[model samples]
Target: MEHDVPSLPEEIIVKILLRLPTKSLLKFRCVSKSWLFLISSYDFAKAHLKNSNDDRLMFGSKGFSMDLYTWSPQSAADHSAFGGTIYPPLDQNLLVQRVCIDCPLYEPHDVVWFEGSCNGLICLSSSDESLSLWNPTIGKAKKLPNSGTVLDFDYYGIGYGFGYDELIDDYKMVESLSFEPFAGAPTLDIQLKVYSLRANSWKTLLNWPGGHAFGGSGKFLNGAIYWSVHRLDGPIEWVIVSHDLSTYTFSVVHLPHLHNEDNDDVNVDVKVLRGCLEICCERNTHMDIW
Candidate 1:
């Protein structure tokens, strides 16, 4: 006797499917044609990004390679937070998914750097002046048009950043570079350029007023991107310079007062934690987060 199994209601099916882990959802797309369409839709992507609590960590190297580790947090475990990082127990096993990053636009040997990621989209750049926006979940990539000269991060104090502008619904990139000394130039010469996905071009912005930006990744939070900067005029002071994504204006964030005035050699690192800005100071063997 062949008993026909009752089909689940479309609404009920969507409700259950949207809450599943990302790996299972990705695999279940092959269950049927409708499933595939629902899983691949832009609306579904946005819902999954917001609803799904699939904690994932992406680790990449210079090669066109990346490994993703996904694990659920322990419900009853205690966590210690520091420098924008949460310390969880390391005993539990994690599922590692290896995803191959292919770039037909640039050579695989080119040194790769992770510019930034926003709304599940990742942006990467290499030494060859190539910029690409990649979605690891969908296994797809789009090479962005060359903005201008190659903004190499290898040089000290040169950094690149990527983010999304919600007001315009556009993805943007910022390149902060250290320029060579010229006649009549200040103690430090830095140039900034911003790229808009909708405009499809880069526009030169005013010079950074933080004196000099330390070589590091831009920490994007709230509505701005921040970098560790140090002023060389007067006494050496480390501060954070932020560029507002919406207004395109520059502002300075004062670092926490050092307990020891003599400890001027402390290193400053800017980071975003739980939707807030934080700075990690390291002096000798002591470290503090502010």
Candidate 2:
């Protein structure tokens, strides 16, 4: 027979659950069907994440798989790495990704982990291998069913864009894959896909013209996600691609004129600072900020 305690009010129960550690709450999900559904809701996820007191540090695995891991660092007393730094006590949550080598298409350093964060949630993906969203604070995670398509590393490039749509209260991810499939074919074939967390599904988005978005440089600001794209459509150019979350539309944000013709290779990185978008350009020997 199941031993039952005195019934507690649902509000009281929720308040108590809020105080419990994420591991305990996750285990309690199996106690009842209603509790499982409640714990799985995105609204509750936001609440739990906001209520959490833990801070996280993410590191990449050295193994062949190149998976991701998040852990709370211990103090100087318990760890030697923090010997000189001062830190307040922090809650500990160690969430490690299981690894089995599959030889990723790109180098381990090329993986997209610190791509972006929205309301304490992070999107992680690598060269079409796998994509997932994780909440490090509460130790909850949801892996997308598919990561779309990937091409050979020698002829492929990918970029990830992650942000929230406040109008719909939804979190979204954009995956842009550019590749050259055949020897005589065009150098760039761009395939785009977007995932909506609230809908719990992935959908194909309209393709941008011939170009490749630089992986791991997505910047979110003013309700749009932006990436630095190297254009291959007609005249070669390097520009920023911004995807508006609310409309699912795409547009180009051209860089300011930096008069130079001899600079063969240019690098552009996008960032958001002080409530505005900032672009940095590197051409051969000099760097420009705009």
**Which residue pairs show collisions in model 2?**
none
lDDT of 1 by residue, 1-290 (tens): 99999998999999898888767888999999999999889788778878955444444543454323332233223332322233333343233334455545446565666777777777887766678888766567888887676534334356777887878777888888775465445566678888888888889888466657473668777768888877655565777888888789988867656648565467788866446777888787788887
- The per-model lDDT (C-alpha) reads 0.70, 0.68
- Which residue window of length 10 is worst by lDDT in model 2? 93-102
TM-score of 2: 0.61
Model 2 lDDT, residue 85, Cα: 34
Q: Candidate 2 on 149-247: residue-level lDDT in tens?
A: 645656777767788998998898887777777765656677888889889878887656435547345778878988887755465467788889999
Clashing residue pairs found in predicted model 1: none
lDDT of 2: 0.68
